[model samples]
Target chain A: MNVPLLNVSGATRRFGGLVAVNEVSFEIGPGQVCGLIGPNGAGKSTMFDLITGVRPLSSGSIHFMGRDVTQEPAHSRSPMGMSRTFQIVRLFPGMSVLENVLMGFQPKFPDGVIRSLFGIGRLGGQERDARQRAYEILDFVGLADRAGDRIDELTLGQLRLVDIGRAMAASPRFLMLDEPAAGLNDAETNNLAEMLARLKADGLSMLLVEHDIDFIMNACDKIVVMDRGTKIADDIPARVRTNDAVIAAYIGKRAHDAQH
Target chain B: MPLATKRASVWPVVAVLALGVALPFLLSGGFQLRIAMLIWIFAILSMGFNLLYGYTGQISMGQQGFYAVGAYAFALLQIKLGLSPVLAFAGAVAICAVLGLIVAYPLLRLRTHYLAMATLGFGLILNGVANRWIDFTGGTAGLTVPPLTWGGEALGRTGIYYVVLAIAGVVFLLHDFIARSHVGRALQAIRDDETAAAALGVPVRRYKLRIFVLAAAIAAVAGCCFSVVSLRVDPSLGEFHILVSMLTIAVVGGLGTRFGPLIGAAIVTILPQLLLQFGAAETLIYGAFIVLFLLFIPHGLAGLVENVRWTRKSAAPARTAATNVLEVKG
Candidate 1:
């Protein structure tokens, strides 16, 4: 569909003798929110790592936006419109909220690099624009007033939102989120879901790896389920809800009975 | 440092620079100027070292390795190649830049303590070469550097002191700019959370390598300045003692603070001489001061002055902000 924004073919990763992700393949189209869900130890995070170029795949290939990027480094991929947030909150400490987000914009090093190297180029032209845009992003992330506050002062849920803000800062065509709602409470989770929906409506593509089945079911256009490192189900929400294999593998017979 | 908090520490920096400029006139004695020059030289060294460890979160305890290489390059260039002091110092810095580049790829492949140890080992190896490579380095006997000439007359103590002061100013400006710019934030991000930084697109390895090389070159600049002042280069320059001293200056000054190196250099350089009258008590008092500073003012001397400091952001927000978004939306 429109040259699938992300095409992963036979993505596999093995740790020593342990195959963390085995021959997993999937595609996400433009403006689609694809959820990757599975039980613990199912290699959801590992799969995120491979797709984002944080870790090299043991085998297979990944293509993004119409080019093979299986060997591209994370730093390079970021400039090419790939962005991600960690399962763990990974903001730079000791910086202001705006500073962390400002990092999302590099102003293209070559723009005034000589002065930057000499310590004279304060990025006078581009920096003002960067800061203005960073402020706007801070406003969007719901931390407009907290922009000047030190990052360490924020709450856990706010930190997750900051991660989202930071990911958005890059203006990425593809965003990979690793358990964005893992530590979020009910209200925070709802806020996150709404944000995802809004991003999708804006035509941004996203890959969300999460454990909250309800949130995944609600937000994703399609869901990919894995257990024991193998992808077992890939389907739209309605069909997957009643599929016998999907129900048994994910919900389990006893849990399914309890739900019914 | 965040945007607002970074603005808070400006006064101390201004005061330091003003005092640095006025230092020569205030102290008329060559001996005292020598000590002041020493302070300035170490301050430059601290600035470089801090760029690697403080801002970038990469540790290199063997900075003396680069420093010694620069010194030797400075001396050998003038002696063997007949290059002028300016050209020789320039040559030395160039050599250091290349050396830093060559070493960074392999050395920076390591992280944390392993990187520290590798750098420490690098320093020791260079120390050995400087000591044993007698034909080139003059062994422990050292190489005597000719005084830099201005209008064919030796610049003398005062002139050289200002030279050192000028170089220190330039280095400080460079260091400060890096701290304030987007590049500075990137370095801090890499230090705070490297994986995330890479995901955010900070060329982590390249940035790490750049700082490492920048640090090496700055150390070389300090080395050339030392040769002009002391006019000597020996194995002791690259020894473990020197590395530890440089580290103390950076740590006690402040690892990542604006005025840390300068403030730290002034105190660490002045404190020992202040106690020299006590003879044996000098070492004891100096050690005690370092321990006390490290124990009490853990954020360093700069940190002690600035009350509102930046804290690295973590992934989790405070629980209080859980419904914070809803409120904002409402």
Candidate 2:
């Protein structure tokens, strides 16, 4: 009976003759962790692109917090409390971890570029505040000790945490993570799942596109399964796990591959 | 955590300031002072260039267009419009900033090489227009700017040099402030990964446009200083050679480092003057230095300092890991 935090209806993205995402519809409710699972090239990332306004929707619409945001640009979406991380970790490689996270506090710069140029705005107080917030987020993501290290010095798992830390610095109400568990060891994956659960407990909504089956199965409140740009299943994880279409789309292929 | 390290940066600022103050008096010779002044102006130019290329990672081969606009605006505003030299300088920078903003809308859409070429095209058009507009630009013969005067007394050579020095000092401080501020971090973030910056709410396109305009405005300020120093405005200020030289200064000094542009500017400005005795061989040697810097020390001289610091810091971690062994030995 409540408006979803993020709603997509018949969202489609076409690349020339190929339909990357075709008439896909889903909704992620407030404080809910919705898992988007699909085989490779099932338009999972493309769906994120449409949601974040990184790519224009060929058809249909996306509404965030019950308002139409399909026409907005990607940068504008963040101020509205929508932040995301890339499938491949996208930390600012040249910057220290603190500096990278500090960049996420951009919305707090109310005076914009003009006042900033004259040295009137963000002189000391705002910078200190941002730095404090950056460290806090780093601390939250277990990267507080490594805040001074350059991104290049970080291991892949540490870099992934840094990405999440930067995203978290934006203080988003809804976070979209594209394959956050990829390339992470089992312990790191569990660590991420625990972090996501804690974020959820704090009433943050999340849309996670991941291939880590056990991680998603254990963590997500609901799971939406996509196959070839179409939604095959959307329900609570317990029911969705038993659905025939979901099983055929997932385990059936694995079983067939096992035969080979 | 590194409060002691923070204090280290202050010494360099003090040293540069002391050097800036003492240079004019120490030089004494007019030609040497002229070279110093030129170095200051080009340093300002390269600082602007670094803001765009070094921090934001956007290359503009069309900076000379903005430079020429500044120089000509200063000269023409004084000569034709009868404005004061100082007022003309301000007006020129303002005009260039506005022009930069106007150009950014269409220009910033092109990424990397295309953006560079688009800017180059803009500069070439400016050059052609300056050459053809005889009535306005004096058709390559150029316009002579009246000596900067206040209360009917000319600034003369030394006064003009000091005026430039003061302005250049302000620009340096402003550049340093931006480099250390949240703005500098934002620009560097955009350079590192634009999409990620946007996702973090950096207003990527807007910041890009602003930096482009800001860089142009600074270049215009440098051009205004050049006009005052040379007292001449010519189409050559907007030529391809000026763009290449400015790019060279930015690269050779070290992209993005605080004092790299200033050091690069000094080397670039002094090198040709020193090589005057060697005729055209000066250009050959200049080109060779650039090649060598690019090949061996790609981060420029600033990068060399970073490497030294890195090596020193790198030793500490090794010692920390071997602390148990040291304890046993002790």
The candidate that achieves the highest TM-score relative to the unseen native structure: 1
Candidate 2 residues lying further than 4 Å off, grouped into runs, are: A117-122, A251-260, B1-15, B276-284, B306-330
- Fnat by candidate, in order: 0.65, 0.54
Error of 2 at B53 (Å): 0.9
Model 1 chain B worst lDDT window (10 residues): B311-320
TM-score of chain B of 2: 0.89
Q: Give the per-residue lDDT of model 2 (tens digit) for B1-330.
A: 211112124357558867988897899689999999999999999888988888787889988999999999999999888998778988999999999999888999776678889999999999998999999999899889898886789877888888898989988887877776777778877776777777888788888888999889999999999999998889999998888888778767888777788988898888877887988787798778789877877667764654432212223223323432432342
Which residues of candidate 1, in runs, are more than 4 Å off? A107-115, A118-122, A253-260, B1-19, B310-330
Each prediction's DockQ? 0.40, 0.29
Residue B316 of candidate 2: its Cα lDDT? 27
